[model samples]
Target: MLARLTIFVLILMLLAIGWKAWAYRKSALSALRKVEVISERFTRTDFFEEDNRRWIDSGERPDVVFMGASITSRWNPEGKLGDLAVAQRGVGGQWPSHYLLRFRSDVVDLHPRAVVFKACAITFRPGVNDKGTRRAILDLTAEAEEAGIKPVLATCVPVREDGNTVYGSDGKKLPDGINDRMLPFNDWLRTLAAERGYPVIDFYRAMADDRGFLPADLAVDDIHPNDRGYEVMTATAKPILETLLGAGRG
Candidate 1:
């Protein structure tokens, strides 16, 4: 009876250990799957592959190419910006690094006369400095110049006061305080553009309210522009783009 009891206890211990191992493996797999999803979303280098191929096949070269994040993607510069041929290559939910990664393919390969670089407000969220972002912009500008393409720097639009909480592609909440860095980053962008002799489109000045937030009427959310907001942006960008295009022809 004693031996049988001891064997029963040993079997129970083995069963418990097996269950724990299985649970651990399941948890690990779940975490890994989440990471994979994020990685795929952020590293979408081929996001514009099909569109780019179509453009290339059409043999139509644009006079200006707008390259940035979601805001740029939603901006329609076609008939709004005079008669200049414009191509939109904005990818939503991407960082400056991603822009740099696809710069040659998206901007340079299209061979536009000028390229506008407007990273979104999310690129300079709270706790982030401007150093790396500056470097990436410099690299992009330099590459464009080397390829005989002019580079234009556009200020990022401000976020709405109430639209503070942004979400990541993984359905997680992003950090707050995006508005804290918006103005300062735009200032830096202006200084950088001046130093590099690049033209800047002051979208923030056109879109921000007196308190420096995007007004409710102009914002699609905290970080994007509504139709009216984009109209303001288009009005602000028209003169700059026209000047650039005119000078490029000269």
Candidate 2:
């Protein structure tokens, strides 16, 4: 009789665990599916590829390419980087995984000497866990090396719910400890770059205020950098880029 009772308890425990897993997966998928993206067909095929094809096919091969999500897509490459032949491919509402999907076609094909890659806050949103984000970045790093392109990884810009509703459609605040959770991932990135001898751009430190929120002057929304913010990023990046471009491919 005791054996039968033990077996029943084990069955109940397994069912409860299964239910929780299913619920977690459902919520993650829901959050991902609702991201309002600029490219209407982001998941259909290589749709966003067209956004940068012309520049890549231009007679000039760019010295560097800034590949990322919104922060990247919105940069004025020439204004920010310099007058050189630099390319950018940023799509708002995209996670690093999405960038990875097109890394070969959009980034590798351009044959830039190096790529300035930025991590997205959206990766810290619901459903997308840290392991998933880290894996995507690692994959990009490996692919860039295989293509003979330098990979310059960057941390995400500041994040806060103080200014705008970048977090949710209804303006719901992020979970109380989201940034705290993000620290581990950023730390991992820094360590990875150091171990691999890659350059890790510390954008978070450049933009975050004392309390870790983006100052009003720097961000148009809670998630995106404004003109002044972009200026700061440009200033922080140019020196490093100049060094890389100067070195070239020996």
What is the C-alpha lDDT profile of model 2 across 1-250, one tens digit per residue?
9999999999999999999999999998887777635333774226446645775667456778888877887887575565556777777777788878678777788788888888767767766767778888899989999999999888778676454223454677665445665667778888999999998778888888898767888988777888988888888877777776763432
What overall lDDT goes with each candidate model?
Answer: 0.83, 0.76
Residue pairs whose backbone atoms clash in candidate 1: none
Clashes of each: 0, 0
User: Clashing pairs in model 2?
Assistant: none
Top TM-score hit: 1
The candidate maximizing lDDT is 1
What TM-score does model 2 achieve against the real structure?
A: 0.74
Score residue 156 of candidate 2 by CA lDDT.
78
Looking at model 1, report the run of 10 residues with the lowest lDDT sum.
Answer: 121-130
- Segments of candidate 1 deviating more than 4 angstroms: 1-41, 126-129, 164-176, 247-250
Compared with the true structure, the alpha-carbon lDDT of candidate 1 equals 0.83
User: Could you tell me every candidate's TM-score relative to the true structure?
Assistant: 0.77, 0.74
